[model samples]
Target: MSVTTTSRMRHLLTYAAFVAPAVLFFTMVILVPFMRAILFSFQDWNGISSDIRWAGWSNYTKMMSDTGFLKSFSFTIKYVLATTILLNVVGLLLALVLNLALKTRDFLRTAFFLPYVIGPVIIGFIWQFIITRLFSEVGKATGWVLFQKNWLSLPDYAFWSLIIVTIWHSAGYFMVIYLAALQGVPKDMLEAAEMDGAGRLKRFWHVVLPLIRPAMTINLFLAISSGFKGFDLNFALTKGGPFGTTESLAYHIYLDAFTKNLFTYASAKAVLFFLVLASITLVQVAVMKRREVEM
Candidate 1:
């Protein structure tokens, strides 16, 4: 081969060497399972058996008749909305507060980020005990109406409790993302705006926020996805308790497949979930990207 041809061949081999591992792993880990799920969604299999019957659209059709599944889906939506809003707001606020050069900024950042490092299931158990025991004692001592009830046992309070724990668990990680973005905001631009008689609040609203829009976009997407498929925390905290009022879609699906032996039904739900979440996230990201471009 000519020198140029030899160099091109070498480059092709180098690129393949770098990309081959990831492609193989993705196929083995993601693609294979996803394809299997699609197959499973079309069949009636009790998660284990020699008998696997083709059920066509029965699983999907059954979901329409399944009120609990429908309710669990609606519950998931409420959770997504609550966590998406609270996580973004609280995370952004924490990011703004900790970006300041306070004497305790470093310590505060570490403290804030610590919760995100802890596993959600463990956090759920801790909060469950705290609410059931510690808060009850405090309520008895202080006569505080808020802490008097067993919050986890009540539907309304259980819903709010889930939101609070999710926000507390995830807000710090998103805060770190926002903090990094905030640090990237052009200080000179803010100073120039200040020179133009723009107040601090005005500068923040117009300049700083616009610059950090990318991070906001990312945090919103993460919060939505995390909330939609919420399982571990909901499992550990409520176990869909009281009257199944706090049952997340994930837990509901888990019950259907593992508890009720409706593997095909649960697989169908998972497929629908993947589709709906993907569509919503895509639309949200697109809209936010457009807004970011405008700003």
Candidate 2:
């Protein structure tokens, strides 16, 4: 009833008002689904059946013995590594180029980032058509053998094609991140390096890289996570085709739950996939944080 108590009550009400909507939404969507997924991982739910019987660790045991799942898991790791490295490298290069004084830098930045604005499903369809149709035509016209083979039909080619498309789509977005970080570098330090006879490459290697380590950390994390969890583009482009060689873990999870109606087994795979991602991300963050502190 006093002035302090009334002010405290009003602040509490304001906090509740802001937090209530998000809490309700999270419970309805993320928290509920996550809890249900954990339960389903231990059951024998066929995704459509009314009877759900607890099967203990049968799903996890089966997952370990499943050759297809193992193959997909391996493929996912390869994709993640390839895509992460390429995305970061290409993004950094683009950012460096754009950092130079150029009349078309803004235009180029928009052009590069435009692909990322498109939905992944749409990008997949566009790239699928280009690889299938345009590449063959261009090859015929130019006598180039770049598109001689069916890009989406061959396993190795399809895998690399997906990687290329993913990099093309994502590099620009990361470039923007790197560009912001690059702009934040102390210009006086760069000027000092130049005065000290540090050539461009030397400057980048010694001065620029250490200063941009924070951006590198963030960019690497995003690229790795996105690469590991990539699904829609693969679905549209390869659909785990050419004898299932292109099947990623995410696609495998979708297939198990939706296509095969093995919800419980899919849930187990999802849980395992989440743990793998978490472990890798945590290690990466710790290493990067240590490096940042050293810098």
List ranges where model 1 is wrong by over 4 Å: none
Tens-place lDDT digits, model 2, residues 153-177: 8889999999999998899999999
lDDT of 1 at 133: 96
What lDDT does candidate 1 reach at residue 74?
88
Model 2 has an lDDT value of: 0.93
| Range of the 10 consecutive residues with the lowest summed lDDT in candidate 1 | 58-67
* Model 2 ranges with Cα > 4 A deviation: none
For all predicted structures, in order, the TM-scores are 0.96, 0.98
For residues 24-122, could you state the per-residue lDDT of candidate 1 as single tens digits? 999999999888988999999999888999999998998898899888998999999989999999999999999998999999999999999999999
